[model samples]
Target: MKFTYKIDEKTELKMLDLQESEQLFYLTIGSKETLREWLPFIDFTQKVTDTQNFIQSTMKQYSENNGFQAGIWYEGKMAGVIGFHKIDWNNKSTSIGYWLSNDYVGLGLMTKSVKAFIDYAIKDINLNRVEIRAAIGNKKSRAIPERLGFTEEGCVREAEWLYDHYVDHVVYGMLAKDWLNKNKIKRV
Candidate 1:
């Protein structure tokens, strides 16, 4: 699968690579406190090597047609990461996950990036269903799916283990047919 996706002039999504691990590592470290509240694995990513390993693993998954992770770039800076956790080819479905730097919040960059990815998943990749799971209190994260017209399927109680506790997750789902019927989303 192709690794780069240009959402617009201001934003783009490119597959994670080992060469960028240092940058990603610093970005993660800088956002550790903010990201730790909802993301369980942040604490484990203490060094650049961890980020490099992650990029290597993601590349392996991409080669295997399992899934892929991409770095979200906004105005030439690496602002976040977004990707499918797994693509169930047999079922024609996939689950998406994303995290943006605190500085980039409220810019609608993720919403636009996700919309473009969903469109690519359904139209180009031929995936029929896409799912997004966000922690119950993460209104900003949940809003992306909502803004793009995903249905709230249900809640998974204590679905994710945060640093010190667990948090419930709200599941959102969208089908290819529904996506195609929705109003066209303009690229950001």
Candidate 2:
């Protein structure tokens, strides 16, 4: 089945398939230096086949009801990827991960895309909580969750290994009730 979610007329999220792996690889290549600063897995993706393997794994995640990663297409071009990490069903919670090509920054694209994911997690999937964690020094990445009104829960000291060193993360969380209330959505 086809999986697509439109964030707006100019942007949409589509589940990645093997055929689009090359495009994704190129996007990563173009943004490598910048992406590597905040994302730990960038070094692991040194080839197109790595991207394909990622897609295949995400497909498995979808089939197993874990969660899926999706390509963020902007005006029909592969701009980035955003996805829910493996879900904690018992807790009705999940986290989101995203990266945009350096070329696509500052266009309000990530903000819009994240809003859509939050809506899906809360309204579509009946999830109770959504969280985002970003390296403390990565302002741009942290802004998405902040702009979307997620609460700054706290910090995890040296939470991730970037490449050679550790980077602390600022945790942001949004509960379904708070998100719905903020959006003025009432549950039936």
Candidate 3:
């Protein structure tokens, strides 16, 4: 489970040095100012340093489990985060999630990033499928998959609680073949 690779900046937006989509920004690490900007969008009250430490620690875990966790760069700084979690190499599946700094909302960077990541995962990593789940009512979060052509699998009622509230979850997924077919059409 050695997850080590130099992701090309052009091929992987997560690795890009300049991340901007009109009004949004992206970065891997944030400065003190960035911390203040993103603090509210963050679901936890932990210090910025704590978040950084958690990123480092989780990266190690992802490496151990043979997966990837990439920082979503927005504007000229770190505006949000996204990653592939719980990779099952044997089954060639992974779960994806993301959060945006409040300032970067309404832009379509997540959709772009998700599509790019999916392409990377399926073609580069040779994964068979990728899944995305969001707690119901999070329309902004859930739209990423729908806009990218993922099929709605179903709903999981009260599957997990977030911010002290039990939330329903929606699952979306895409297979490698479907992804390839869609890309082929786009190239036509």
Candidate 4:
């Protein structure tokens, strides 16, 4: 597996490591309020150990060949994370989930990172389908897939329990033939 993905000169994604727990935890705390609204795992992550546990789980996921979680680094700082929930090899499909630090909202970082992921999924892994689901209220999050030309498939009612309330999600999908990043280089 690739250790790092250079999104650009200023943006990069690294496979999450155990040593990054502190930095990851701090980044999570810094954006907890904003993240917690849409992500159910935020409230459960209260300390560095919690972040470490998450990393361990991702490590297991990697070892099992299910998928991976990558830390988003911007200009040498932890900015966020993007990852696959799992790969359904039988169907050649996978679902992606991501979160960005509140500080780095409008830099077009997420849109770029997501595009790279789609390219990797479709071109590198030869996955036939990619899906991204975002809370209906989160316009910014939902925009990534749309900006990348993903088709808005449908909505699932109360798809996720965010702390105390269930939020609806809009599902966006792209097929390998529909992905337009034909010129991207796939890491071997």
The lDDT, on a scale of 0 to 1, for candidate 3 is: 0.64
Between prediction 3 and prediction 4, which has the larger lDDT? 4
TM-score attained by model 4 = 0.94
Tens digits of per-residue lDDT for model 3, 39-139: 33334433445445555656676648656566555443445566787779899999887766656666666776787778778887788899998878777
Those runs of model 4 whose alpha carbons end farther than 4 Å from true positions after fitting are 180-188
Top of the candidates by TM-score: 2
**TM-scores of the models, in the given order?**
0.95, 0.97, 0.74, 0.94
How much is 96 displaced in model 1, in angstroms? 0.3
The best candidate by lDDT is 2
- The residue-level lDDT of candidate 4 at 19 comes to 91
**Model 2 lDDT tens row, 58-90:** 999999999899899999999999999989999
Residue 165 lDDT, candidate 2, scale 0-100: 97
Model 1, position 61: C-alpha lDDT score: 93
Model 1, 1-188: lDDT tens per residue? 45898988999999998889998999888888999888888989998999999999999999999889999999989999999999999999999999999888889889988987898888888899999999999988898999989999999999988867889999999998888878554322
Q: Higher-TM-score candidate among 2 and 4?
A: 2
Candidate 2 global TM-score: 0.97
Between candidates 1 and 2, the one scoring higher on TM-score is: 2
Supply the global lDDT for candidate 4.
0.90
Q: Which should have the higher TM-score, number 1 or number 4?
A: 1
Query: What's the lDDT for residue 130 in model 4?
Result: 96
